[model samples]
Target: MLPCPLPVFKGKNCRFDSCPSHESPPSSLLPSLLSELGVWTALLFSVESRLQKGQLLSLVPSQLAAFCCFSENQELKIMSGKPILHYFNGRGRMESVRWLLAAAGVEFEEKILKSAEDFENLVKGGNLMYQQVPMVEIDGLNLVQTRAILKYIAAKYNLYGKDLKEKALIDMYVEGMRDLNEMIMHYPLCYPGEEEKNLNFILERATERFFPVYEKALKSHGKNYLVGNQMSWADIQLFEAILMVEELKSDILSAFPKLQEFKARMSKLPSIQKFLKPGSQRKEMDPMGLEEVKKIFKVDEDLFLKHMS
Candidate 1:
């Protein structure tokens, strides 16, 4: 039998199924390989030694290319048939995409860019279009745009709607959520002087205008999901958008009973539960700066409570 393509297994008994050229090593072997090769060095090895010994002579050109110096983590990821999601350390725009990925049960590697240098390198390497993040590398294709990525994953995992009209409705709902997001994203900096004004605008004008639309939509649908009696990309987007509002103000959604129930139901989903559990890629919910605003503006406690209420 041909030797296994893995370095540690290279010249030893090929423990993997179907010998060296199988689609993937057995899962039972993963613990040992991870220990021997380290995480990043997972599958790559110098094949020159194996070539001189004629161990890999049966491999095709494509197989040989895969066995080259490049890391096999990507290959293994492809073998697992899941995508790699690249985003900044913070949730930001990628939260919905992450939610969709989890809800769809698509295993994905989260590449968190924690520094400006890391982001710049990715942009300089031409991996990101227009130098923006929330990019996904899946099945040999790199995709950008949060909505597009979510749609692609949803379609892949069958989380999207069942028909064309259902898809259109899903798109419509997602667009509305994006509109609400745009309002809050208007001033991410939240300058101390404008913090109270911005909060008031969101509470009074934006909330008044947007929240009722969603509340009505939820009641009209009369389902746990936002669209078509099932979870879709739209549901995930709206959920994350509501989460952002919750982070900004704890009591914002109390008035909308249907939405409160909707949030509770989605949070209870198995995939969402796994995503929310500690030690995952999930980040702590930011207070969205009510306290920071009070401290920065030196506002009195009583006055702050009155404004927030």
Candidate 2:
């Protein structure tokens, strides 16, 4: 949208200097790395660069803001009559929140951030930058970060856990869901060198560490959902981890049959089913790199043998 002002730099080292520096890549991968670095810069520097390019980006509106701007201003800055959710089109992470809100019978608005500039505008607004997307702009205030937003909305809609103990348990699994979701969404973004290390780390921890935890948690609960008999944020988060994103191999779902069932069961929810409709994808500047990055997360192949060994 912004005419690619910050062109993606392939196969070259980034100037950020702040990001963890690796040894200079060989000649073959240099261009690719440079290009990927440009995208990395765009995402990482969006908030910082917002001011400099504010005017240019102002013309490029977010899906959420665009929807809001066209509509007449209501008495409430945001309307509870119809709940609104701001999401990036193809990035379906917010669908989990959509599912949660729908099941809770909340009516609201849904807005999507269509471009990098749209994201820039958001963070430029101070409070808008807190945790970034899956943001819930209540009334006029922007609530960033998914977990906190989810919890806040859940509580607002009375989806909170039954008791202190239940709340704690609900939170525990929800956090697990949160961590796993992040890992799945981002593991592929790491550079090739970083991928071998990071992917191996993720898989090992996922298998030896996190898997046992999930397996035990599911076994102990002995139920469909993560916490109690009812659905919670954990379900939304876990279901999303399996449902959304690009991958290296089969993803985290195939090995864990319980999680597979968890995903299948969640798919049956009307709200979640409705979310399957095509959403716009956040276009990547570093197209070549995005694929490679996505592949880092793909573990369907014998990654353990190749990288871990």
Candidate 3:
């Protein structure tokens, strides 16, 4: 039997392009054919497969290499090892941290936990979080809470700040964003119906408390990154925090024009933009939940929608 065609390309995992079966379209028909094809999932997968096969061919350990490459067990191992594990809630707090790790090109297994017990079992031993929404286990070490994980992963990936001052700045913004995110995530727990004497009392209290601090932080930093021009874990944390608030109660940001501009810049990031689109492994925010939160906060819903663009 003829083997599958090989396509050719290169990246961390998935090699379909290098398949031996891969063949160019007749030179004359290449451009028109490609234009008709648009994004080439099939061709790309083929290219990836061919590449993997080539790597297999290069294994020169004779008998052992031949057995491992030809056997089904090794292929199973390759498939299983492709993902790293991540534990999180669909809520923005954990989602933000999850997205950043992916943005940084980390491989992970994703575990979505809905209950408290799920969290407890997952934590090999708690280092930080009082709750379980976001946790990570890296090479036998388990970490709880979003910020702690972000800091360690960032430093490991060379995404953290360059110096002590920058790292300090990272901490400053992360703490601020964390405080705000906690309040926002917990908003529904204290919800009260409208016209029952006051509108969205719980949200009102949270907004009054958190937004002012966020505003001041923006003001203190002169509207750039918290520390320096380089992208730090802090920036990533802050960006995710703001997205939650924006998803929940957007008009809350109008009061802080600096933060609003920052939000705009953050949403445009190539990684973020692609992730927000349909079919990203990451999930999008709940539009109705956002609207409900806005109503609770008495924010300008129309203004918030304008920014979703």
Please name the candidate that would achieve the greatest lDDT relative to the true structure.
1
> How does each model score on TM-score?
0.67, 0.55, 0.55
For residues 1-309, write the lDDT of model 2, one tens digit per residue. 112222332223223333321222234643564365342221111321222211211211122221110011111121123445665553335655666776664555766555556656655766556434557766445676666677887777666777788889778777766676566555655566787787677666666666567667777778988777887766666565554331434575556777667777887887666655555222222324434422433333334112110
Off by over 4 Å in 2: 1-80, 86-99, 102-110, 114-134, 139-141, 244-246, 251-255, 279-309
* C-alpha positional error of residue 270 in candidate 1 after TM-score superposition, expressed in Å: 0.8
lDDT of 2 at 13: 29
Tens digit per residue, CA lDDT, model 1, 1-309: 223345443322333455442233455676776565332224433433221211121222211222322233222211343577786454556667777887776667887665556666777788777566678887567888777777888887777799998888888888878777765654454555898888677666446877787788889857777777888888887787788787678888888898888889999889888987888766554546445534532455444322110
Q: For all candidates, what are the clash counts?
A: 0, 35, 31
TM-score of 1: 0.67
Tens-place lDDT digits, model 3, residues 94-149 = 56656676667554567665444554555435543453435566633556555666
lDDT of 3 at 97: 59
Worst 10 residues of 3 by lDDT: 62-71
Task: Give candidate 1's total backbone clashes.
Answer: 0
lDDT of each: 0.63, 0.52, 0.52
